[model samples]
Target: MNLLHANDRPGEYPASYYAATATEGERFAPLKGQVTADVCIIGGGYTGLSAALHCAQAGLSVVLLEAHRVGFGASGRNGGQVGSGQRLEQDALEKLAGKDAAHAMWDMGEEAKQLVRDLAAGMGLPFHAGVAHACYSDAEVAHARRYAEKLERDYGYDRIAPLPDGLIGSAAFKGGDLDMGAGHLHPLNFALGLAKAAAKAGATIYEQSEVHQITHGPRAIVQTGTGRVSCNHVILAGNGYLAGLDQKVAARVMPINNFIVATEPLGADAAGILARNVAVADTKFVVNYWRLSDDKRLLFGGGESYGYRFPDILKTVRKPMLEVYPQLRDVKIDYAWGGTLAITRNRMPCFVRTHPNVVSASGYSGHGVAMATLAGKLLAQTVQGQASGFDVLAALPQPRFPGGAALRWPLLAAAMTWYSMRDRLGI
Candidate 1:
């Protein structure tokens, strides 16, 4: 079963809360004949749209092709947290890429958040501030405090503060760190704004134009079912949905399914769950993330499936949401959906030059909201012959799955199952 069409219809966005709230723009016609451009972008999520907008602003001819609608994938369906720093903490990054390089990576991460903030502000998007990292154990709470202090002292970043025990309430959370600089928003709206900006800046966007094959050379030819794009450079930004398009990206960036559920409006009671209107992500291998929508519905995301098809979305996600907010046990679920996102072995992004003229970036490991947007800007820079930022990310190590493509899902399922068990046992 192709993951692209496994759980959703072709050319349509998932019936997600984001889709319901998102403002639909003028739909672009699918590619039906050959076209030429300086750069061809595959995928229409934050990454591709950001790249298209920046490249067009730089006066480069650009064509962006999306299999479905823009932000139809994880970009629109995610929990909408704009997290600070890399997915892996800075100390871990220091060990992975050394101090100076890690610091540089940290700066890049800050730039990523700023880009999202500035873009959303310019578009009048509903961007809010506050992300609380809830801890389940004393050990985790201690670590959160230490990490916040380390970030302030070493990186000169000081937006994060530890949450008091009383503020954690009956959610069973011990303590946590609140990052005022990081926040959440209507993810689909942000993506659509980027699409509009890209189009205004002169990037051609083609919806329902899925790329089937790419012929790499001095000039790359990207083939769709009914048309093709001949361009000097091609960017692979499809992430988990780009199944079998490039073996290099497939080998390193494996796909996984995550589910989310939105509850009925709880009115004033919603404040009891999250007193500060901040997003909360717990300390679990299978992370449980949630936040309140502008209308007071709880948008909670949790559970992971290793299969091509999603399990029952409503049932799979509701269990975790209840665990986090038992007060909502009787609340009705208004929306539930599943989305596939790519992940790397180390949970860091996979930025690679598959071919000299082709670059692919994915495997954000649940941190794509900001990083993927930043990636698009970096891709635009590389196309303009300024690759210093892109080079830093591409140099990070990405190891292939031990079982390769065919058996990767089974291996990942086994490993994740074990970790989930450990999480239950509090190990």
Candidate 2:
């Protein structure tokens, strides 16, 4: 089944809280005829939109194509937590890519978060600062304290503090680090703002224009259902829904569905769930993350599925939300939705140049909010022959799944089953 249309309708956003409260503007028309540009971007999420804006600002003629509405995918449906570092911790990154490379990667991560903060401030969106790491055990708490100190001493960054009572109203958690620099926002509004900025910067955007094939050459021809865009460069930024685009990138990036639920306005009860206006991410292999919405509702993301079809989202997400806030047992679910996010075996983004003129970035794992935005800026620079940052990200390890794209789902499903069980057993 095609993930593009498997769960959500064509040319429309999912029935998500983000969609209901989306910033109202710019419904881009679909590609109707042949067009030519300096760059053709396939995907309209954060990566593609950011790339379009940056490329257009750099005076490159750009055309961005989206299968459905812009930000209709994970960009809009995400937990909205702007994390501070890469998917892996600094020590892990240092091990994966030498010390120098890891430091550079950390710098890039900082740049990414700042870029998002600046963009949100410019768009007049309120960015609530603080994201706490919710640890469940003494060992995990000790590790988090050490990591925070490492960030301060080794990295020379110090916005994180250790919270003894964790950040949420959950007895399951002991305590963890709270990074005041990392924060949350309305993800859909941010994406819509990016689309507006890209349009203002002269990037041609098309909705309901799914790219079916790319006839690669010096001047690549990216064909959609209705029209085609012939450009000198191609950027595959589809993320989870980027199946059949490039077999090479697809091998390392496997798509999976994650669910979230928004509860009815809790009024005074909201403060009890999250004492501070910040986001909390747990230490589970299948993470349980949550934060209070602007209207005093709890927006919780959790649970996992093994296939193209979404499981009962309200049921899947509420179970975990209640696990954290058992006081919310009788709370009514206002909205529940599922979005596809791609992951790699090592949980790092897969950045690769499939061809000399074509670059693709995806498999952000769960760190897409910051990294995906940065990937777009780097992609624009690479397209313009200034590829220092892009080269660094590309130099990082990009491992292909054992069976590439074909059998990865089944294999990963089996592995996730084992991990989820371990989580249940608290092992």
Candidate 3:
């Protein structure tokens, strides 16, 4: 897909409020020769860095290789909402994984939330908490109602509060489900903080180092352009970037491109428009998620597809934003960018050991920021011989998208088109 070269042009950062406000750090030197470690992690995004952080804390030697730079992929560019739960609701998860397993999964969601906070605190990053979902449609509100009730009754979830439409105070949105625990963050800042923590904890991270091949064994050898590392275990945290890396891992999770656009500063009117200062997302197959940056700019994200091609990010994603809040039509878009995330057909994440010495976790479907951090912890546990938690997660039934490899893209496009159509029509 030429992902490495696609968005490398000058000013690709656009005017993203994140880029403007980020605390830029010294770049890590690229891998130039052979190396070895207790564990070698591919992809230096959140998952790899988190895994490296945990493993390094456990006093295990760790080496991490990044194709570009840390936080260069979706981990850096995401809408920055630390969304709660698995991609699906509690009822659907319980129905699929049975009552006992579902309970375990529910607790894991809370763990994911806590993990982010712990990382922030441990690394001295300012992570302001306040993540909420604004239901843009009446049907979406109904789903949120059912979801909240199911969480309370079946999963013992009590943190969610439903805001009535009248109190929501925005003619733009109908109503919303307020999850005070699920907060917004500056993703790049958070990721850089973690990378620094991991490095300080003794994990060696190399940027511009791509793992091109793997020699499998009890101790697998991870070979990159400039070096090779032999480790007792390997972790694939690349997500969508794993596209051409490994066929087996790539086959299970399809890479889907999602884009986000940022608007000029909205000022104190931010709290006036939202009132509660909570992050918001509408419930739809192709969801519309938006949040106010620390600087008060509207950073909104929408648009998903199997292909990697992205339009003018500002123009492509602006229409979707305006559809929900027509008042935003006149708002000047300052930055627009896109990154790919892996999405399984079931909309549930999968963690699998593709081979005996190697394990991979991807397909968080849009719920990765939290899940990926949790998965990294699980990966550490598995590598340390405490496989119970990791095994339970691996047991989740994740079906591959229907269709042969050659037809997967077309098949997904058709299904997504229909689902989006239904969302638009409220069917």
Model 1 TM-score on a 0 to 1 scale: 0.99
1 against 3, candidate with superior TM-score? 1
Q: Write the per-residue lDDT of candidate 2 for residues 1-427, one digit (tens) a residue.
A: 8999998878888888888888796899999999999999999999999999999999999999999988988999999999998999999999999999999999999999999999999889989999988888999999998898999999999999888463477787878888998999999999999999999999999999999999989999999989999999999999999989898888888899999998889999777788899988999999998888999988899998869999988888888777778888988998999999999878988889999899999999989999999999999999999999988888887777875556778888999999999998999
- Name every residue pair that clashes in candidate 3: none
Candidate 1 has an lDDT of: 0.91
Q: C-alpha displacement of 371 in model 1, angstroms?
A: 0.5
| Tens-digit lDDT string for candidate 3 (1-427) | 4565565542133245666777875488888777888888998778888999999999999998988878877788887788777887777888888878878887888899899988888767766666677776787778888888877787677778887454333576677678877886788888788799889999999888877888888888888887898888898889888866667767778888888888888886666546655677777779888877767787889977666576677776887788866777787888787887788767787788888867788888888888888888888778888778788778887777667667888999998899989877877
Off by over 4 Å in 2: 164-167
Q: How much lDDT does each candidate structure score? A: 0.91, 0.91, 0.79
lDDT of 1 at 47: 95
C-alpha TM-score for every candidate:
0.99, 0.99, 0.94
State the lDDT at 331 in candidate 1.
Answer: 94
Per-residue CA lDDT of candidate 1, range 229-325, in tens? 9999999999998899999999999899999999989898887877777888999999999998999888999999999888988999888787777
